[model samples]
Target: MSIERTPATPDPNWDRLVADLTAAPAEKPVGPVLQKTADVPVNRPDLLGDMPLTPEWVRTPAGWRTRAEVGKVNSVRAFRRWVRRQSTEHGHGAQVFRGMHRTFLWIQGTEGVQVATARREVQQAQGDYKTAKGHHGRRLIPGKEKYKRRAEMDKAFAGSVTAMSRYKAAQRDARTRRAARGALAAAAVAVPEGAGIYLIGGTGGVIATGSALLAFALIGRRTAGGELYHDHDVKFGDTLKLTDSMLNKIYRDAKVIGADEVVELLTPCTLTADGKAWEVTLDLPSGTPLKKALTAKTGVASALGVKVQQLHQAPGDREGRLQLRVSLHLPFTGKPDPGPLLDLNCINLWRAIPMGVNLRGQEVSTSWVERSGLFGGEPGAGKSAAANDLLLAAALDPTVALYLCDGKAGADLTPFEPIAAMHDTDGEPERLLEILEHIWTVEIPRRRALAKEHGSRKLTAAMAAKDPRVNLAVLLVDEWSSYGAAADRRVREEMERLLRLIVQQGRALGIITLCATQKPDADSVPSGIRDILSIRWAMRCLTPQASDTILGQGYAAAGHNAQDILKSQRGVGIYMDGEGAEPELTRGYYYDDDEVDLILGRAFELRAKAGTLPAGSVPLADQLRAVDDDDARVLAVLLDTFDAHLDGEGEPAEWLPGSVLVDALADAGTALSADSLGRLVVRTDDEKAKRPWLGSRVVGYPRSRVLITVRDRFGMGE
Candidate 1:
């Protein structure tokens, strides 16, 4: 049993007690140095009364205000004597060690509070940068001048990103190898007299002492790596047998980088690490900037020969927090392998779709079922490639309908236009606003109505099988910040409201919205929305702050430094799934242009089999069948639709309505019309003459086809 250790509280009458103790003693002046020292024995009769009430003191004019300090000394010695007696009488070895570890960690926590400034600075810097963005609306005050302001923000952001990347890397390395010094030595306990030594030569010790030693040494060493532990002949005890000894040694020698940038022991013999945990908590050295450890972390860890996770070691509590806790899980310098490449090309879409390989080399994946996602990275940082990786998976699913959007000149998204249910690429604020409105007034309500009818919250696969309209509608937006920063006030406000609604309620209705951006700022993506994204991926972020922005707050401090990833490592990033607690460094599956064609081809085959194709969606295979069947007839009608009917005057009209085009095609002996191929793919008026505009007018991508049939299905456009 452990001894009661309730500490004595501060005296309410402290002044009176001090005065009474210091006054001209009616009995004897005990603390005259020699007087008390000579009288107090470890076994004194009043040992209990002599113990120090508290572990603090106040000074006087002579620099010795507190009286009875001498008794404190005797009290400590008497306690040690009592502990030894209890150990001998009760064998409380485990309890004694537990007390030691607890006391040591408590002391370390006190010290750790003193040296946590650098971490505080990092957190503060992150907050301040975000605050500055919020205040400026980040030059949300835009016009022709907006371009210039944006350029300036970009430049400043670049510099900050570079500096943070370096800092994150340094801090990460510092925590990886903090306990790697001190050579190991081992010896067995001494055996009593004539105890039979269980050596190779058990019975013949006196014949030749020196010869026996040589014989034992030769027999004990293993031929493979000369490892003594693996050799049965060796008598050394396993390290586990001496875990307590190892724990004490680690705790005793813990250190931090000192003022002069030198590794200084901060808790030598002052704390005890738990044997099982193998963790040390202790005070950091005074005046040592946490940066010292960050900068010299590699050298210190390498020298110490102990590889530790900086996340475990870098936490701090206060400016005066000199205390830090560190750990080397499984000890030494080993790391787990991340494993083999995961092929996600043909996996079931209902399952956790393969994302990529993570830091531990394990294949990571995310479930798209009822979850929204955020993809964050720098330009050419594999965001497009990863998005395609997702598209490949979704396309393969029978119950998924893709909606594509890109503010870029359309090159990034044009290839997949044929496959999308709703596609938008125009840089026009009005066009994007219209698309959001269509979804808000059309798709959202229809899905909600279906959910109500089915008595379901989320449209599961079973529900989708029963109702074709319950299939997943994936809305993908590229360059999201540009949409938010649009000069049009109406577009900006309305878009924000719809985006929030989609995020808040779309999951239950099978409308999953995923947006990719070059940068994630408060102004670009609302912080509130960013926090709830079920999946977050960051690849090659410019700064640790950006990494945290995508992954969540305090992610950078824990050393998930996605920003440190190099631009060259395309398709490699960190990913967090909704199901997992921790974020992981993952490399997205790489798919080239050719591979995309192949995946899309396979998706076409799968969707054809499942009969989940949207109304008027003609697959590439059907297009081939049309080529063989009614190619000539359809071609003639397509041309007839564009033939000019001078509107009572000689001037030709710029565009014809969908009903007009459909009638003209019917008159030319072609049953197919704009409704059959609508919202699919027509770029120019000249091209529309050849193919007829197949996309909706609401989302006017230069090469989009909008079907009046598809839109009017949801009560859009009258």
Candidate 2:
């Protein structure tokens, strides 16, 4: 039977419903109504409006309004603190004693005799030359005529023999007089036996002794030649005081400004309390550009009688102005202070890590997120030490997973092995390739998935806190030249390709790649990799070209030359963050082995607490057990393979190709593959690798090996 439809039931509500569905909602309540709605706190009152000022805010003073004020305050505090510490720790008493000792040495007539003898010899030589020149003009002919001229010159010199002899006699007499005078002075200062007790007991006698010592010290002070004694690293005296006239003279001598141009001193010359450096802000004369002064920094240093590295220049507030800082002593001469991480138990990877101090004595920090760094310098320039600072920072952060690849074969970065998720120090190209493959295929994809799941374009600390798998990852490759110098061409190419991919794509995924190499050549660190690295740290490179290679072209020309860095300035480097500004000179903090060990132990504990220890987020002991499981699996596969490939006489072959064993393991339903088996056998040569089963008879490339022993010597199995 057909169902009957109610066609007559056309309600007025149908038209109203259609109109309501099609009509736009009343224009979101214009103006104040909408503003009032938005202003209302919805579910989260903590995130709404300006906070009410509390008593704390009202009582707090309005701190420094400008950076200069803050810097000045901090500088004064640091300088005073440093002075107090140095005075106490360095022992000024010892310096005074040494100075007195040096004075005694000088007054013994030994130094005076030597000085007189040197002066006599120099004066006699000069007199003889002058006599010869006066008699027989300065010119000497060439060839046969040169020989004749020399003979004539000798005759003329000989003719002045009487005058030379007289000069020598006079010099000898003067030396004798000076020696007598020195002896008398020494005798005058000698303590009398009768007054020894009084000198030891009486304050007036003490004053007299001090006065005598001061007089001797002043007389004995030698500026040239290393005769003066310095008991401390920093000498407590003004090397050069920059007056307005001195500044003008320096500019004129350096040829940085025109002869008629005078520097307009915007600020008075201020000497640091430590007496090690002085700073001044000044405007260049009209038409004299600041670049001229910058380019002539070496000349300025020369005029100031200091090393080029001692002079630091920065742009002032306005154009054609400069802020000049002159260090009396070479920078980075003092022992480096320990870094902040030395005391901190944990750190946050999202914030900048205090890696170093700049030339201005201001803290220089580096943020790891979304940045890659290239550290290049000579072998002994402390590039490794600088890189270690960053590595230690990563270790302190529980959320950072460290992958250390030391091309120096564990000599440099072995300490990090305990906490690193993956560490390869032998610099086998294929091994590094496998690590990169794992990071690209596994770690990066895992982080990307987490980011997508959480609706984030980049991994955040919040996400890392929730999931350790999405935590920050750092890959540090030290001495990259070792890997680049791989014997296998294909392996090197593959590594470069994988490294480039990770560097370009892994940044947003919280993966940072840091490369350090002594060889700054293009072959060792290809421009392809170098250019992508946003941060560049160039230590004392051998040449400006090498500096340019590390810090990017034109950097050396722009006065950020790493080659100018003195060999003595270890750990000092030119740092560029790719911000298209002038690079900064920074000295990396010294982190010794003991400090590294302490940080590593703390890091291990922190990661344990956070459940982020890389080896499946388990404790170290569990991680070892997991490693043992793999070793056991490999042993079992080898034992089974030996039984499978037996001789006709029921004996296993003494040696077997690694490939043959790999196929047998695959057939036995084990995960061990040829690549894994090769790594096990090939890395046996590495002193750090734990391979009790793999014998020395294993041979061939990293991808293939010939195993020499498969049977147990204990006879537990056939």
Question: What TM-score would every model get versus the actual structure?
Answer: 0.45, 0.54
Query: Which tens-of-lDDT digit does each residue in 153-243 have in candidate 2?
Result: 6865664664557656766765786677666765666553226536565665666677665664465454335355342222112224455
- What is the C-alpha local distance difference test score of each model? 0.54, 0.68
Maximum-lDDT candidate: 2
Model 1 scores a C-alpha lDDT of 0.54
lDDT of 2: 0.68
Best by TM-score: 2
lDDT of 1 at 216: 36
- In order of listing, the candidates' clash counts read 42, 0
